[model samples]
Target: MCRWLAYSGTPIRLDELLYQPRFSLIDQSMHSRYGVETTNGDGVGVGWYPADSPAEPALFRGVGPAWNDANLREIARSTTSPLFLAHIRASTGTAVQQTNCHPFRHESWLWVHNGSIREFAKLRRDLLLAVDPALFPTIEGSTDSEVMFHLALTFGLRDRPVAAVERMAGLIEAVARTHGVPAPLQMTIGTTDGDRVWGFRYSSEGHSRSLYYSTETAALQRLYPDNPQLHRLSEETRLVVSEPLGELPGAWQPVPESSYGVIQKGADELGHFEPAAP
Candidate 1:
């Protein structure tokens, strides 16, 4: 599995979370504490929404370990975004290439995932065949994560995200069952459309990968009374990650297994998540 994070709220420099945190994504790239593999150096990618452009988010990706990427560090220090998704890849039987990096994009949406479809080799063809014919040509990589993004798009992610993802999961499981694979899916996914962000945690056998979201800014401020930065961020600021970015007490909350949630301008919403009929 990989490591990833989705930030939504105030427009801030990427390094604020990517490099500055105690256990930042850059640190996770080489020494991840919670991922299946300690080193996720297969590839790395970052996607962020520019303040002036709402139609699509810009992406920067490379087929190198993030910790050693000078360009990544340069970009992280110079760029800022209101919303962004960053990922450090650990191949789950996929090639190490830019196309296989996470934070895959389609129009206004950006997506990243931290897990895989068990025995993808057994069901890859079937799953690809399930994607809408029009959308198939747009799939640029062979990784299950990118394929899963297109599957959600085919299932109507733009207008109905949660349901679209649920349908996508359903299709993966249906194909897996036909292939005799007991557990077909394992994912901790994050997706956004330059505005709101949605995150999901689920797997076929019930125990999914670890995922967490930052505690509300209000709570953090109270917990770290002397930390002025905590009080500067909006109360609506939120971060969903494969693991907590830091060890600050009460600064993160684990996302419950088999659930999904939305992060928007106001109050965030969390609810049960389950595959539905495709």
Candidate 2:
């Protein structure tokens, strides 16, 4: 339903990923080849760690569509960071408002997603009630994405990311099933604590939303030996996106349907994930 990308590596110009690629995130906002929709123009957000400070990331988000937002374009060109999160939204039953956009922040963490709750309204009340009281007041949006964020926080995401996320999925699925919502909750979530990045792709059913991660740096270097831009990157630089930004046939690999991946300083680690209760 949406498009997003998480990058961890050497500090590079934002334009390097959002504008320079053959099928950049900006380009995808106007022309997406594999997302549920061809256009994701409801809103956009970018979160990055400033070079001078790695623990806290600065986030800029707006209600306007990405392609038409000059401010977004300008920032993409001017800002640079080693770890960043970017999202282009295609609202699913939510208003096209700035708060509804993603890369939602809490202290040193940032998160984004590319899917929706099967019947969010039916379970919103119950889900909201389950959030940690301290974090509940901080949730400023109505999208399932934000709800999911709060859920993770409630489960202690800041302390145990993997387990918290697993609990989040479990809670979401349980509520959905109790309300009679069918299986297959399409979800592809990316989260970062300004250091390590975690990307998840899963559904209640076997098939989930499309998600891909770049090949290991050394492998990519071998494949694109003649490309200086690629060679300049360290053996650890890596990318995880909802869809491949370019048609680099061998550059991207699909994340297993029921799996989650972790990236730290450009290195990737992957594992299987169980569906939420539903």
Candidate 3:
């Protein structure tokens, strides 16, 4: 299990969200409230799309505990972006290396995941083989999370994200069935193409990991007019996280089980999610 957060709208310093909240991602790295593990210190990574238009997102990753890393702190304090993703990993079996950390990138897209494929070791070979040959060469790590990212790309993530992910999940389950495994997927994922961000919560079994999205920014500002942070963000600002960052009573909404959410420049959407055959 792991923890992550994706933010869109309003260019703000990373530290404002990564460290300023009561239960910020930095705090979650050492004391998570909903993740399977409280300490996700195996590694940490951040990817952000600059405020400038049509630019490739920049990335920074470290194979170290985020709470203890001076470089991470400095970067968070100095950089700002309109869209960004931050992740702290808790390896399910992969080596603890920088490349294995999340917020994986390809072209302009950035992705992160907070759960694992059940018994990934059994399905690894088949899953790897199923990836598009062109993408296979770009996979730099051995985590099921990274492989899932590539599989999504192979299935047309750039052109049709939601369906590609559905197909990826379907294929994983199909392969798992052939190997006598059950409940093959468990994930709370965040992905963006430097424009809109998509978040999902799903598993082969009924139960999935925790995922949540913030209430509309303008509404929150009205409720807590005295809260300066709320005022700093624009009406389009939104966040999708592995858990609530603060205990603001009406500020966070749990993503419905087996569903997907999209956060964009204007209106957002939450739609039923189902895995279809690839």
Candidate 4:
């Protein structure tokens, strides 16, 4: 299990979201209130698209707790981005290495997840074989999260993200069933291609992990009418996180179970998500 957040819209310093919030991702790393684990100390990663360079995101990651990383704090303070993804890892049977850290990237695309594939040891080989051979060499981590990213890529994530993810899930469940394992998939995932972000909440048993999106700007403006920062942000600004960054009333809305959302420059879109044939 892990914790992650994806931000889009206004360009803001990483610290404003990763550190300055009352319950920031860094705070969640040690005192997670919703994740399966209380401490996600295995590693941490941040991927951001510089305003001047949107085609590729710069990434910084390390094999240590995010709360204790001085460099992470410094980088957060200095960097600003309109779109970014950050993750804190709590190793789920995977090596605690930099490669296993998330916000994994490929060209302009980035992905992160906060759940695992049940009995992955038995299902790993079959899943790996399903990946496009060309992408197989890019598989650098043992974590199912990374494999799932590649699986979605192989299933055509670059073109049809929602359908690609559905197919990826369907393939995993199909393989697990053949191996006599039930309830094979569980995930709260986020992915982006520097333009739009997609988030999904699903599990084989229906009760997936927590995922929430920020309230619309109009609502936020009314909620914090006098807050200058809220006034400064664009109407399209949005944040999707595994848990609320703070306890601001009416600020976060839970992503419906078995649903996915698309966050972009205008009104967001929400749709029912289901696993389908690969």
Identify the candidate with maximal lDDT: 4
Instruction: Please give the lDDT score for candidate 2.
Output: 0.89
Task: For candidate 4, write residues 1-278 as lDDT tens digits.
Answer: 89999999889999999998889999999999998899999999999999999997999999989999999999999999999999999988989999999989998999999999999999999999999999999999899999999999999999999999999999999999999999999999999999999999999989899999999987899889998989999999999999999988899999999999999876799999999965
User: Alpha carbon lDDT of residue 121, candidate 3?
Assistant: 89
Query: What digit string (tens of lDDT, one per residue) describes model 1 on residues 1-278?
Result: 89999998778999999999889999999999998899999999999998888677999999999999999999999998889999999998989988999889998899999899989988999889988999999999889998999999999999999999999999999888888898889999999988899999999999999999999998888888899878778888899999888888888899999999999988899999989866
lDDT of 2 by residue, 1-278 (tens): 89999999888989899989989998999999998899999999999999899998999998988889999889989998999999999999989898999899999999999988888888899899999888888989899999999999888898988888888989888887778888726799999998899999888876788999998878888987898988989888999998898887699999988888889754367998875442
The segments of candidate 2 whose C-alpha lies over 4 angstroms from its true place after superposition are 265-267, 276-278
On the 0 to 100 scale, the lDDT of residue 143 in model 4 is 91
Q: Give the higher-lDDT candidate: 1 or 4.
A: 4
Q: What is the Cα-based lDDT of residue 8 in candidate 3?
A: 91
Deviation of model 3 at 47, angstroms: 0.2
